[model samples]
Target: MNLHVIDTGFFKLDGGAMFGVVPKSLWNKRHPADENNMCTWAMRCLLIEDGDKLVLIDTGMGDKQSEKFFSFYYLQDTITLEQSLAKKGFHPDDITDVVLTHLHFDHCGGAVSLNASKGNFYPTFKNATYWSNSHHWEWAMYPNAREKASFLKDNFECLESSGQLKHLDVSDWIGNGPFPWMNILFVNGHTDKQMIPIIKYKEKQIVFTADLLPSIHHIPVAWVMAYDTRPLITLEERQRFLPEAVSNEYYLFLEHDAHHEMCTLKDSEKGVVLDKTLSLDEL
Candidate 1:
């Protein structure tokens, strides 16, 4: 099995919001803000090539949003989804499975695109089966007051509408897959039922750290995001996942870290600190 890091591009968000309860004095140093007080973040995605199946995890914030809508996030950098795929000798239509971690605009927005000629939304991966959980699917469609704006209807609706959506509930997640290396674990707190894929390749386990660990800076458990609906639950979730990662020597593949691609954890007096940072090629 081969894993590829697909970088869609970078965007900016308030550093304060990204690191909940953590003082700006600390986080600002980690990710320095621009004059607008927005810190830049990478919308990194992963491509898993196991035998005949090509699976992509999380599409970055797509380019379909209006100019006014995108101005808020300040989506910069030109590394587009199509360009990234082409670099790896694949195209959007070549993806067999698209595992959505959650339906947030940044996570699943690139799953669909606007066809200029048709004037209708369509699945970005024409031949792929887009995977998302039933609970999360419902949560996104009928979004609550807190997360309504982030869960864009155009992103989630296009998948099912195009007959490319597949719901994977709690009962459906078995570690072993049709492809021997891939497995998924569902966690809540960030959103309802976010799916994090754990890939077992040879002796190493590499987990796709979704929002649970957006960047290496988020290794400190208390450095949870303000966006989390249940911050306390997020604390509990991290306590469980981090220790297990340390014990088993798991390589964490961060989605939003622009500087570091992957990291291994080590227990410190202050809990888990990043042991080492390296690219996927190093593994």
Candidate 2:
């Protein structure tokens, strides 16, 4: 199996929102903010090429939103989803499975796109089966007031309408192997039943830390996002997960960090902290 880092692009978001209640004095030192206090973050995605299946973990925000809508986030960067896939010698059609960690716009917007001529929404990966658990699907479909803006209907409804949406049973997530070579870790703190793919690769375990651990700076137990509905629940989930990640030496694949691509954790006096930083190719 071969793994590739599909860097969709970068976008800006309020650092305060990203760091939650964490003081700016602390987070500012980590990811410095611009004059407007917006911190740039990468919309990094992962691709796993295993035999006949080319699985994409998450799709970054697509370029379908209006200029006025996108101006809010200040999206930047030259690389795009199509270009990133093409660099790996694959196309959207080559993706057999799309594992959506959740239905957040930044995480799944690229899954569906607008067809200009037809004036219709369609799955970007025309042949891939888009995967999301029933619980998260329902959560997104009928989004709560807090998360409604992030859960855009256009980003996901087309997948279901196109007859390409598949629901994974949350109950089947038992033992170490839920989906052949990978196990899933579910946490409801960030969003209900958000699935984090724990992939086994080359004698090492690589975790796709989708929002649960957005960046290496978020390794601390208290660095939960403001976007999360239950901050205390997120803190508790991190307390449980970080120790295991440190003990087992898991290579965390960050989805939103701009500076650091992947990182390992170590047990420091202050708890689990970043041990080393490297790219996917270095791993």
For all candidates, what are the clash counts? 0, 0
Query: Estimated TM-score per prediction?
Result: 0.97, 0.97
For model 2, which pairs clash? none
Task: Report the C-alpha lDDT of model 1 over 1-283, residue by residue, as the tens digit.
Answer: 8889999999999888999899988998888888888888899999999877999999999899899999999998579989999999999888999999999999988999998788889889999998888899999999999999999998879788778888877767784344457678788989999988898876899999899999988988899999999998899999999999999999999999978999999999988788999999999
Off by over 4 Å in 2: 175-178
lDDT of 1: 0.90
Model 1: residue 205 alpha-carbon error in angstroms: 0.5
Best candidate according to lDDT: 2
Lowest-sum lDDT 10-residue window in model 2? 170-179
